[model samples]
Target: MAQNGSAPVWWKDAVIYQIYPRSFADSNGDGIGDLPGIISHMPYLERLGVDALWISPCFQSPQGDAGYDISDYRKIDPLFGTVADYEALIKEAHDHGLRIIADMVPNHTSDQHVWFKEALASEPGSAARERYLFRDGKGKDGCEPPNNWQSVFGGIAWTQEPERKDGKPRQWYLHLFDSCQPDLNWDNPEVRTEFESVLRFWLDRGVDGFRIDVAHGLIKEKGLPPYTERATMVGEDDDKTPSNAPMWDRDGVHEIYRAWHKLLASYPGDRMLVAEAWVKPLSRLARYVRPDEMQQTFNFDYLLCRWNAAKYREIITDSLEAMHEVGAITAWVMSNHDTVRHASRLGLKDAGARPQGIDAAHEQPDEALGLRRARAVIFMTLGLPGSATLYQGEELGLPDHTKLDRKYRQDPAFFRTDGKEIGRDGCRIPLPWKADGPSLGFNETGELWLPQPEQYKNYAVAVEEKDPDSPLALYRSLLAHRKAFSLGLGALEWAPERKDVVEFCNGPVRVILNCGDKEVTLPEGEILVASHAIEKPGFLPANAAVWMTEKAE
Candidate 1:
């Protein structure tokens, strides 16, 4: 943002460093990471050149589903810090030239929310019951849930909350996420107004923006399904089926966003209201970024692609083509707190077997130089559409160490009745701030939320920051280069000759990446950036890439 206050709240074209508070750092010597812990690392993030930081949910919660289960909208979770500590953080972030956009969970609150408790206490069929998504006799009978839907973590999405009648306790509350994370009855105007007040509370506190959680789940039908078991309706998977098209992509959601825009517009700055819709297809993903809705939304498409040249290029093309709205820019992410880190997702597992064509290090025919080659491709990735978001410790080249021990595991989804798949605890490990410090410099005392992969101690900032070829240094240079390009526009032009080459021309700049193990012949062009073997200008080796502009013919 400009010192003159002309800058917007969107943090447009700026990089956001996502911090998972429980793992970022610990300042109070409490084994768990906290707000003050994150504050201590501000300087590291500053030197890293990120414009803003997106901290995951730190709101008051039962801690059942981590911080996602909010027991109170405006209150702070003691596990993190007090509300004043958070306010001080926002102030500190501003002073350090960084903005803090917090995680806002509006879809639901913990079943412990006063309203839910009161609703549970109220008589059946009363106005209170209508305030939530509930069913009679578990709805449609036969133990069927409201519909055929699954939970994201696993298991049927619906759970019959303990019916509690005022003096007693009776009537179940429906939770779309965990049993405790009951969905708010957005159909009610009162629910809408309640959340609006929550919005104003944070906005009034001078928070820069909000990363809305499960934003799509906020609006669900008021009526129960024609026929379905509660378990089936609550199956644990994203609702791939659009919410009955008419009501699904209805004007209601758009109206919600537009209304927020107006309310937020009253406050100065370009405040952001990013949605976390687990939607699919670039087309569907584009809907959340409606000019009036949200300036930006996550494109899960890029995150799901294979770590290969051909697929990567296709993803780039799809992203650019999908988000061509007049003022709407593109967003790219290789890693996040929710998914496996790019290193492991890209198949760079140290103990794991090699990918088909590429060996353990992705040393395929085109990648003669191993990870260095991939980093070259990533340079172009970071420079492509919208603003790029980097997960914490990604720049240090942290691999997904999600392979957790049975006892240390806390993932609720992993314990679902069906069974367990490794959860995302790997990517959420504490930052390795020092070369060989305890918990990789995460905390002064107490155990880390997750174990630091043995090798991470060497991969810490203290070690990698000094080495030019280190991932950290490379990311630093790449980010600076990306920020230098104000347009942030590029056309992923395919190479005319070789199939292994991926070439993109953005304005006058061109980037070529060789995906094969063998050397690649250079197109007739002038070199601007080269990842490997720049010593000999024209020709590029396997896994090599070069930046270029049209040669002065």
Candidate 2:
């Protein structure tokens, strides 16, 4: 059990592993992963020692934005499986003493959704049209978009409806992401009531909670004002978001969450909600987790922090302080489906840089250095006083498929940006479960939606499971230690300042990370586990981290 020792609050100190359903496994021998594939791997997840699983969206989608463009909230996509498959997955996960957190997308729905279809067919100012953001074009002829807001993918945010048979002027609809994903107008009471029921639909089916997609974007600023600033992808900005940005992190978003929180509280099993808010300024982000709102939010600041010890220290301190103020636990993340794998990202020439995608022409990441740093960081993250979200394949030390060809790219961001941005396909490639196979054991038929890199063979779980020093082994050990010590629920204390190193104590365990090139002398304690082997006694290698307990008197 996790530190909280209560069914309702397990998330507060749990290590939740994120499973990108499309690429995790394919039990049906199809190229794409399905719910059955996930059920087949329950034992693997159970052995991983994570307290819960945060499965990415598998709801009926048009595959636009890779499942973010949800079409039907109540139905599971056939590509993944049917409703029975999802129910079985939930049951199997709970059977293994694990909790399941579904990805709920309330901000927008696919243009193919029934609501959007009805809205498109209905006349302007009708209730159907009111469900979404539809407005007359600004110019007299109504050919121009209502506002200059740009989509997060690319181009203008508004898309004009097709010409009508009656020859009436076309109206434009707002989509912060791709054109296929029309943003819902939360101002409509009907929208609120419908989404609340959507939450209940999943909660009733036995899901432990939800990881709310674009949690900060549900409510746009009133009047839908034009945003003149350059548009950037989500989770890219490090500084504070402008108060008048027009769409993101608006104060009204809290009301929606407060009601959802109440709905969740009414249910049994301590059902919870986690926000994927990419909002800035630690204090502002804290508001999402205030007493009556979400229980947790992803700590993107920690994920974006550079490799420098000082930067890591600052991010950790600020994150802990901010969450403490709200009486909520912090959730630390190193990588996810949306970002480049840390094993590759940390090894880049610029450790702080977050490229949209990597191709053959891109400068190659330093694999050895990146894997070394990744191991060290994971050790540090596990020892911290909060929940840790481990992305799939990170335990196998997987890196981005940097050489993925453009022809195979399916991310909407790629097409929307006209190939200027490579998109996230490289990171979403299927996981390698075995060392020798046509598709690295992702499926029986060897078919793959995205090609796997040649190097993936070396990182396969089958190969890692037999190697004691592998990242997989290290993760199991770290998780075991974390649970035994209740580290996630313990307090963090900074060790004496040291040059080019981050040292901290969580309960009886002390963690030391060496960011400098030179070796550091070991402290007086019994070594528990180290990211790298210590060639010489009493010395820690550069870019390595170790956990230790106090020596007996």
lDDT of 1 by residue, 1-553 (tens): 1244554434557688888898888887666789998887778788788888898999888888888888897988998998998998898888888888889988778877788777776777777766677664444432445455555565666776563434342334566567777777777888888888999999899888888887656665445444232321111232333434322343456667777877776777667777666565567767777666676776666655554667677777777777774346676776677765656544442211221111123332221233454466666666565677788887887765534454665666556633344555656777787866567677777477767767777778889978887888877776776666542543445555457777766666677777676776787877755666565556778766766778796
- TM-score of each model, paired residue for residue: 0.86, 0.98
Best by lDDT: 2
Tens-digit lDDT track of model 2 for 181-284? 99999989999999999888988899999999888888888898777964454534465345457788899999999999999999877788899988878898
Q: What is the lDDT of candidate 2?
A: 0.90
Error of 1 at 382 (Å): 1.6
How close to the true structure is residue 342 of candidate 2, measured as C-alpha lDDT?
89
Per-residue lDDT for 212 in model 2? 92
